[model samples]
Target: MRADAKKNYSHILAVAREVVTEHGADASMRDIARRADVGLATLLRHFPTREALFEALLCTNLDALTQTADELETSNSPDEALVSWFQEWLVFAQSYRGVVAMMAAAHTNPDSALYAACAEVHSASARLLLRAQALGSARADMNGDDLFALMTALGWAVDQPSFAPRADRLFQIVASAILTNPSSKDIKNATR
Candidate 1:
C-alpha cells in the first residue's frame, strides 16, 4: 500500500474502533468514514462491510485468546486451564458491543468474514477441552463447539445491562454443567 493509503486505512480502523465502542458493531460505516475524515468510498474500499471491519479488530484479540489457551494448557491443570480459558473467552466476547451476534453467525456460516476467526477460536479452545476430557476432568460428551455455544449463550446473557451482574453466577452454573468433578479450588483459580 502507498503511504497515504496506509495512513487512511489506519485512521479508518482507529475511528471505527472508537465509534463501535461507543455505539456498537452496527454503527454506520458512513459515520465511521466521517469520523476518520475519509470518504465513504475510501472506507468501503478498505473494509467492504461492517463484518469485515469488526473481524479485523477481533482478529487481534482472537489470536491473543489462542495464545492464552496455549499458555494456560502448559501452566495449569487441564480442568483449571479449560475453566480459566473459558472465563477469559467470556470477557473477550463482551469486549465489543455487538460481537456476540457476529460470532454466532460466523459459527454456522462458512462464508461470513468472521468465520475463520470463529473457527480459530474454537480450535484453540478445543485443545484445552480435549485435554480436560482426556484426563476425565470435563464431560466426555461435549467438545469445543459445545463450549462455544455455552460461551455464546453467556455472552448473550451478559449483553443486557440488567443481567450483566449475573455473568459470574451463569459461569458457575456452566462450570458445574461441564465439569465431571467440579472443585472449589479449580473454579476459584479460574476466576482469578
Candidate 2:
C-alpha cells in the first residue's frame, strides 16, 4: 500500500469504528467516508463492502486483544492468565453495540472476513484455555470452539445495558464452572 492509501485506510478504520459503534453494524459507508473526510470512492476503494470495513475494524481490535492475551499468558499464572484473558475478551466482545452478534454471525460464515478473525481469536483464546487446563485449573473437557462459543454468549450477555452490572458475576460463574479451583475473590466479587 502506498503512503497515501495507507493513511486513508487508517483514517477510514478510525472513523468507521466510531460510526459503526454508535450507529451499529448497519451504519452507512457514506457516513464513514464523510466522518473521515474522505470521498466515498476512497472508502469504497479501501473497503468495497460494509463487511470489508467491519472486518478491518474488527480484525484490528482483535489483533490487539490477542496480543494482550499472549502477554498475559506469559506473565500471569495459568489460571489467572485465563481469567484475565476472558475479562479482556468480554471487553472486546462488548466494545461496539451488536458486535457480539456480528462476530457470532461471522464465526459461522466461513466466507466472511469476520470468520477468519474469529478463527484467529479463537485460536489465541484456546491457547490460554489449554494452558489453564494443563495446570488442572480449567475444565479438562473444554476445547477452543466451545470456549469461543461460551465467550460469544458471555459477550452477548454483557453487551446488554441492563446486564452490564452482572457481567463480572457471569464471568465468575462461567470461570468457576470451567476451573477446578476457582478463586474466592472472584466468587465473592460475583455476589457483590
Candidate 3:
C-alpha cells in the first residue's frame, strides 16, 4: 500500500479496535468508519468485511500470545506454563467484549478470516497442555480443544455482570479440574 493508504489503514484499525472494545463483535462498520473519519468505501476497501477487519485488528496480538506460549514452554514448569497460558488466553478472549464467540467459530471454520490465527493459538495451547499432561500434572483426557472450550466458556461467563465477580474463583476451579493434582493454593483459591 502507499504511505497515505497505509496510514489510513492503521488509523482505521485503531478506531475499530476502540469501537469493538466498546461494542464487541456486533460493533457497527458504519460507526467504525465514522469514528475513523473515513468513508465506508475506504474502510471496506481495506477490510472488505467485519471478519477481515477483526482479523487485521487481532492478528498481531494473537501472534504475540502464541509467542508467549512458546517462551513459557521453555522458561516455566509444565504445569505453570499451562496455567499461565490459560490465563493469557482468557484475557485475550475477553479483550473485545463478545469476541469469544467469534474466536470459537473461527477455530472451527476453516474458511473464516480469523481461522489461521485461531489455529495457531490453539496449537500453541495444545503444546502447553501436552507438556503438562506428559508431566502428569494435567488431565490426560483433556486435549487442547477441551481447554479451548473451557476458556471460551469462562470468557463468556466473565462477560456477564452477574457472573463477573466469580471469574477468578471459576478460573481456579477450572484450572484445578484440568490438573491431576491441584496445588494447595489452587484449591484454596477455588473455594474462595
How far in Å is the alpha carbon of 134 misplaced in model 3? 0.6
Backbone clash count for every predicted candidate, in the order shown: 0, 0, 0
What is candidate 3's lDDT per residue for 77-135, written digit by digit as tens? 88888888888877776677777788888888998998998899889989999999999
Instruction: Give the per-residue lDDT digits (tens) of candidate 1, residues 1-192.
Output: 999888888888889889998887789999999999889998989999888998887878888988998899899999888889989988887778778988898887998889998988888888888999999999999988898898888887887798888878788788878889999777766666
The TM-scores, one per candidate, come to 0.95, 0.86, 0.94
- Candidate 1: C-alpha RMSD to true structure equals 1.2
Model 1, residue pairs in steric clash: none
lDDT of 3 at 40: 98
Better of 1 and 3 by TM-score: 1
Model 3 TM-score, 2 decimals = 0.94
Say which prediction, candidate 1 or candidate 2, comes out ahead on lDDT: 1
Q: By summed lDDT, which 10 consecutive residues of candidate 3 come out lowest?
A: 183-192
Q: Which residues of candidate 2, in runs, are more than 4 Å off?
A: 37-41, 186-192
Model 2: per-residue Cα lDDT over 1-192, one tens digit each = 999888878878988988988987778889889999989998888888777787888877888998998898899888888877787888777677777888888888998768888888888889999999998998999998899899899988988889888888888888788778999685454333
